[model samples]
Target: MVASRSQVADVAANAFRRSCLMARISTKEELRRIIAEPRPATRVKILDSLDEQSIEFLKRCPFALVGTTSADGTVEVSPKGDEPGFIRVEDPKTLLIPERVGNNLAFGLNNILDTGEIGIIALVPATGETLRISGTAEIHDDPELVASLSSLGKPALLATRVRIKHCYFHCARSIVRAKLWDPKAWPAPGRISFGKIIAPRIGESEAVAAQIDANVEGAYTTRLWQNT
Candidate 1:
């Protein structure tokens, strides 16, 4: 007797589940078996400090993702952006990121205080390549240093200084694959309703959510450079 359509569907679903379970490699050896090793040149490309090329790259980079970890090993990543070259390369071995107006949660900042380690991936708009740097970091509030990192005629309240330990240019394959700079291939933008997210969790009404969203948008426009 021929299998019914439902039986056939059930068989296929079970096969997919089995394949997924079998595809997971739990050991490094199993992982290495399927993935090729990096080329020797790739292995040696990490640098201890920023080179001339790296410094020039920073001159055009306006955005970066900063990564930090807390004492309990929780990780936090924060996005920072400003005019090109907003991040100052204090020297070949050091760099600084000024703190700007933001929500006071301070998860990433507090993580930096708990664990001095930091990693950053700096990117330039419309460019596929990115620069990756990992190093030790310290939060600084020196008046002169903070003033030097200012933007829009307003000095930064604090700066995170990184002592570079490893620096490298990441290949552009990931960006190319994601089509990040290709506006033609982009999907429609989606709205982020912070009020909808927060209000429901707190058992608040739609009116409260609307008020929260209005406050968020107001802050975005008025408080970017300084607190309103």
Candidate 2:
């Protein structure tokens, strides 16, 4: 005898329910064994001071993510980029990074002002290695420093001076897993057009997307020539 569509659906659902009920249930200890494991301390040596290796890595890095926390406990991470070697190492413990044109929200800078504690992860795309630095940051608008970073007569808006506390070389596990530097693994440019994705959420039109794209391209171009 053939069953109706509703009857067939009910029969399939009952089979699924029985199968689920027959499956082995996990005890708390079994669950803990699967999920909880103590992390072994990484035995890599920490640099007592920023050495030539660290400085060279910082110089070649074109991008860094700055992490900061506010006194009230808000956290922010901001992306900073410029030409290669844009970050200057004044000394073993001191580094300077120029602040260029941004939206002026200053979320990361404000966090620095409130807490003084900051973390930085610098990445060199060509090589899969990354450097991590934890330190205190001071914001400066000194004309001399700003002028030194300016190019084609455009002055830097600000400069951040960081006093290094701990500097370490991070393993490439994350990069290797993500295939970050693999050209073949990159997402296609048109997969999700920036305009289509952002316009509605931002209440902006395609013009806004065009403007943002143009600004980013222009900034990157100008940054290459700036300080030349």
Candidate 3:
């Protein structure tokens, strides 16, 4: 007699459930015993009181990763970058970041508007060190602020101003392992334009693909990195 398909599936499911149960620790005490001891907090220096060094680090950082969470608890981390010193450190507890043209999804910005809680990690490539700042963010379209940041002739849409809660320097272990700053270790693959990648997925014809390729390439070479 041969086992039916449903019987085979049921047997497999039961085995998986049994395996999961066996893998789980029986109690909180068991979990605590199995886990490693927590690290001491002595190494972490609080940023509630910032000094000139922390302020200077924020000012010199050209790129940052902005993390936000929505009311429904959906998390989003997005990269924001521009010419050096794009993020203006208004004071020890405040920072201003310009919002440039993107896909307009505004997922990160929208999350900030809803929850206000934000986390930022600033990276200075040459130094291989990073700084993390966490706090609240507000979207601002102030005319004076926009005008000041747009000195390079590009128009600003909005600026994200953050009220920092805590700031700290992250270790360089990950960067060292990845060899991120070593150009010799970089992978050189065939260059593909963003238009080429999206055209097929979006069902665009050959003519439309060429048009998009030109448009996207022009915008980047002309406006986005013009200052650099």
Candidate 4:
């Protein structure tokens, strides 16, 4: 007997992406069964655009993670950070994010160029709450605008203007569980070095590690303030 069309589609949808992670929660029923439903208050938090509270929250956030996707399905989450209020909220429905200097992977920016879909979560220091913003992104190359949002005498090459569709404050549960701001909870010092990380790739010896570390610090001191 042939399976019905719905059953066939269900079978196709349930296919696992990786064999090792095959114990997948493929169906909505499977997902929901393990997680409790959200309260009505949680549902009501989503907003069509930024409101006064959200605007203030954004003003306090000096760091944010932006998620974007390429047309080919590659996903990236890039961090954009500077002074607080670096991300300009031009109006209730508009947001301007300064694109600063970096490693030049440009994953998030390139994805924005490709598909325009963007999701952002703005965070303040030692704060558990985060502001989530989702919308389409449009790149702006006006030098004056870039300069206006500049930091430490350096200007962005461009800004990504987000036309807000949904904005909300994400709850603090995850942050709380992680004890993000607790100095006591932080891992002990002697953290891994970037020099050690790149040494293997660069085929460098212990003597070169110090040179690499110096180069990294010099780059941060010099190029960090250069025009993006």
Clashing pairs in 2: none
Q: Could you say which candidate leads in TM-score?
A: 1
* Model 4 residue 106 distance off true place after TM-score fit, in angstroms: 1.1
**lDDT (CA) per prediction:** 0.92, 0.82, 0.82, 0.87
lDDT of candidate 4 at residue 216, scale 0 to 100: 68
Q: Select the stronger candidate by TM-score from 1 and 4.
A: 1
Clashes of 4: 0
Per-model TM-score on C-alpha atoms: 0.88, 0.70, 0.80, 0.83
> What ranges in model 2 sit over 4 Å off?
1-44, 151-153, 190-228
- Evaluation by lDDT, superior candidate among 3 and 4: 4
Candidate 2 at residue 135, lDDT? 90
Give the alpha carbon lDDT tens digit for every residue of 1-228 in model 2. Answer: 989999999999999999987764668776677777535554344664588889999878889999999999998999988778778898999888888777678999899899999888999986877898999999999999988876447777888999998888888989999999899998887533555566668999888877766655664576544432
Clashes of each: 0, 0, 0, 0
Write the number of the candidate with greater TM-score, choosing between 3 and 4.
4
Error of 1 at 176 (Å): 0.9
- Looking at candidate 1, what is the lDDT of residue 153? 91
Report each candidate's C-alpha RMSD, comma-separated, in the order given. 3.4, 6.8, 3.9, 7.9
Model 1, 1-228: lDDT tens per residue?
Answer: 999999999999999999999998999999889897889999898899999999999999999999999999998999999889988999999999999888878999999999898999999988888999999999999999899988889888899999999999999999999999999979999778999999999999999999989988888787566554
